[model samples]
Target: MLEEEYQPRRVAPAHLRRTEPPEAPFEFAIRTARQSDLPAIREIYNHYVANSTVTFDEDAMTLREWKQKFAYLDKLGMPFLVAESPSGQLLGYALVTPWKPKRAYRYTVENSIYLGPAASGKGLGKALLAELITASKEAGLKEMIAVVADQGAEASLALHEKFGFTEIGRMGKVGYKFDRWLGTVLLQRSLKH
Candidate 1:
């Protein structure tokens, strides 16, 4: 197991802002997630759970469950972001969660990024993850982890690699979903402080 110190710090909302806008007039903006965005976030996530191997979960999350998750992250002050159009349509989201609940693992967090089908390949995933890492560093996180599903999630893996993450471990047949067993790849990226 990996361990690091917990030195929580305040992350300014501005640090989570997107510095560069999309070249095309995509009518989208990246910003911190709000409570109201939970429904759309759930929809996007559930769509993946039901139709793709992006997530290993077999069931969709309820609104209350999503709200609870958002509240917990808010209290912990972890980074959670949303990609939205100017007219308030949610396009995608990215966030981080504790790698493990033990105190020794506090500085290590796992990252997650999800994009709506129509929003993929438009730089939203990259932009959102870049901001997530920046915010995690600002919050004094030492390591970011990605627990990837092994069923052809290349784009997600590539995104992490582009951000300097390296494959640290892989467990075969650790997850069973979509009527088949799947592997889990652990990727790690250290934020040297």
Candidate 2:
């Protein structure tokens, strides 16, 4: 069921922003998406699409398509976020999109985060994910879902787990990419309070 519409946090343009480094050196400012960040986001997303099973998409997305997504998010008022280096480089991004189109799913969202190669293993994932969850909860979402694919989802899984998301189900060999069968894991965390 979930494998059918495994859309990532699909979005487009954001305003570019710069900020002073936080007291913690590892912390980067997580801000709403900027138009400038989309290319960097696409570069990071395309890396996984082409080289790993992070996504089932075999082809990279074009810039125009990315812009269209941003437009759609604008219409929905969905949140799209990006991390910026003090010097203004795009370090990573996380965003939430509707888990499904039906009105019944309005209080639920699916999240996706991608970090640049240079940004990996530096606790950036933790920071970005924490901020994303906070924003999602504040936006009135009652549930958060993470749909993680087999090969490159380990860090994502651990990050979500660290933040209190629990594994709810696993679908075996539900995808195929890079010439082999692939799997997907679903994790859930509730914000129903």
Candidate 3:
């Protein structure tokens, strides 16, 4: 997969003028992730793994690990999605992860959504989350949880809130990334209950 170079589009004080119409204005589609999409999905995820506190994993995920995860989620009949751009670029992804390992927690799942920096500030995140919520209900999940690793995750936090998720807990100083401590924000919404 080719990583598209970022280009500034809108007119800016004459200094940022190269965003021409050579490439089509961006558009994306929401769809279920497939085995073939693991590489693209890993690209978006590991960027944050290497650069941000959005995820607590300090190391990038290998394709083998990703394949295992795919197998696991598939066995649970959960939804894993990807947002593909008009040019066939994967702009973002959202999925339902098991909230915990306990047998009784099968009805509850955690939601994780991430976007490529180029896709930031767009409504793609919202659309993806909405799709996951619907998919979760259809899969018979009773509750959906979100465990955010950053207190500054306003975009993610707000997106979940806008979809009826409510804060249920918090864990302070649970992560340290890029030389600073970060907190975890817990939020939830009932899907079938």
The prediction achieving the highest lDDT against the true structure is 1
* lDDT score, candidate 3: 0.88
TM-scores for all candidates: the values are 0.86, 0.84, 0.85
Off by over 4 Å in 1: 1-24
Stretches of model 3 off by over 4 angstroms after superposition = 1-25
Error of 2 at 146 (Å): 0.2
Q: Which ten residues in a row have the lowest lDDT in candidate 3?
A: 2-11
The number of clashing residue pairs in each candidate reads: 0, 5, 0
**How would you encode candidate 1's per-residue C-alpha lDDT over 85-157 as one tens digit per residue?**
8878899999999999999998999999999998998888889988998989998899999999887799998
lDDT of 2 at 168: 95
Ranking by TM-score: 1, 3, 2
Candidate 1: worst 10 consecutive residues by lDDT? Answer: 1-10
Better of 1 and 3 by lDDT: 1
- Model 2, C-alpha of 142: deviation from truth (Å): 1.0
Q: Which ranges of candidate 2 are over 4 A from the true structure?
A: 1-27
In candidate 3, which residue pairs clash? none
